[model samples]
Target: MIKEKTFTLKDNYVCTSQHKLYALFSFLSARDAYTFLCNWFEKFPEHKESTFYIAGESYAGKYVPELAEVVYDNNNKKNGSSLHINLKGILLGNPETSDAEDWRGWVDYAWSHAVISDETHRIITRTCNFSSDNTWSNDECNEAVAEVLKQYHEIDIYSIYTSVCIGDSARSSYFDSALFKTNSRISSKRMPPRLMGGYDPCLDDYARVFYNRADVQKSLHASDGVNLKNWSICNMEIFNNWTGSKPSVLPIYEKLIAGGLRIWVYSGDTDGRVPVLATRYSLSALELPIKTAWRPWYHEKQVSGWLQEYEGLTFATFRGAGHAVPCFKPSSSLAFFSAFLSGVPPPPSR
Candidate 1:
């Protein structure tokens, strides 16, 4: 009779932080509220429902994969005696798969999209490798970041051109060179339009990690409870805790594709983070028999993006989008989803 909320995913990621877990629980609780709506339709077995899709951008990209895997795996575990839950498909946006090559790929992408400048990209590129988990000077990093966007006047990581630049210190003491969504325009005022509201959610999200204060400390006290290091210590081990748990999207993609699940992996042409090359490696790793090699697709009746369709996966590029897809190009994005939802995989757009 009714349907789940159109879009309900919140900031749940694949990590193991207690505070983060608490926040994620809140997020899931909200999502469950939405999921429960669909259970109503579970009855009336003959009633056809609209397509159920899992979609999100940026971290959503990373999050949706695990979510879909859970659904698919759960569906498989049903013995002969149980009613199966129907899941339609997934739409992974600018995902941050923590692959070494994938991470480094963002630097080049940010530059190409004019998210950062050539010089700034060069500085950060030469200074630090993307895969390693290390802390460097905020000032220096910001300086290199600034140089990259020297020509753009104001650079925005969210502006479809530089989606891979989502990683950052949410509460930066001083402004850095990398023009984020917040810093696109110069504001002499200490509290700019975006930085208002006394505090920012994104700032607090990172602050809890960097300093360990949760739920907003009314009085910034010296008590051990107020100190943020304890949270940091635990947060430090998050990546280490599940050190080798980077699941390959390729194998999973292959299985689904073989099962006739229409699959597509479209990258932002400018995203060096999770660059086209890494995607190629992953797709080829699926061992799908080659059907069509690389080709191009048209947008606005002009050559737009490169593509490849093999036995299992269909790979394409968003001409100007970064890691995130639909956020950058909504029409093409909508078209992509519409195609997937209809099981109408488009011909290869190389």
Candidate 2:
């Protein structure tokens, strides 16, 4: 599935900060992905028949579904010469599906986990109308939300149960506004401190250090006439200027579900950023009929998590896992992914 092709939407390096701000939107990214896929099939024609699956976590909840929808639409609208992509399903972990539900869940999860005071939670739940576009504009709601940020400021908001990285590289002058943003504006300074290496909060810091090395850049061919000075896990410029983001991707979920695409949504119970509660609340809005009653799923003779299968979607949780489920619980995540690919349930405790 790996091949070479060159197509530029904005500039030579699509992620380089020097490009015009035209490629940051979700739909635009999806369109680019579709175009890339078509070009790949045309180049290799032999692998066009392979089953494909789209997977991502966090904000990719939007990207994955949007790309799948674009692929589905193009496949249906194909002419005799057009290629058909055999898209099978999608898998998402601790996804941000709906803005309203995600914010609500953030507040609720913070309060439930004892990260915030009851008074603060009461203030937020009372004053903050998450569904409204002007929620943060309200002074009372704004203050309450700010208090929530203040409470999370000291700890790793992405994984409340884990220790934070105290290294200089992990420190930032401004608050991380990757997930905490208002309707009208996104903070352009710091990106979210997303942890990918299980309990290690400094993984991105290490990655930044390694990727910035002159030798590393030369080895990766990243320094070849690109003028790339710095490499970050996320482009704050693109993130700040992102457009065409739908408030909710539930409509696309409904459309794909009806189209008979296999969908699985998993959550790491320990993730405070996009917590399990947020996923539950967002998915509950779909109201799909339950196909399998909720039950515990086991791995290696131990209870790994719980799962509930809906008519067109499957919801599961990874116990003791943080933002990166596989990093925290590789065996359990592997079992869960195996089940997803095979169209079966995770190992049940008999």
| Clashes per model (N, Cα, C within 3 A) | 21, 0
Q: For model 1, how does the per-residue alpha-carbon lDDT over 137-217 read when each residue is reduced to its tens digit?
A: 334544554344343323343333331123334323223424233324321111011210011214334544545553334
Q: Rate the local accuracy (lDDT) of all candidates.
A: 0.46, 0.74
Candidate RMSDs in Å, in order, are 12.7, 7.7
Q: Name model 2 segments beyond 4 Å from true.
A: 1-26, 78-81, 176-198, 224-228
| lDDT for 37 (candidate 1) | 29
Candidate whose TM-score is highest? 2
Clash tally for model 1 = 21
For residues 1-350, write the lDDT of model 2, one tens digit per residue. 11111121221112112222223333666767766776676678799899999999988888898888777765665342256789999999998887777888888998999999999899888887777656656777676776776777667777888888775343452344345433223222112334332368787778888888887888898895346568776664566566545667787798789899999999999988889998999899888899999999999988888999999999999999888788899888888899899989897784
Q: Give the 10-residue window scoring lowest on summed lDDT in candidate 2.
A: 1-10
Off by over 4 Å in 1: 1-51, 80-83, 110-154, 160-251, 271-287, 322-324, 347-350
Model 1 quality (TM-score): 0.52
lDDT of 1: 0.46
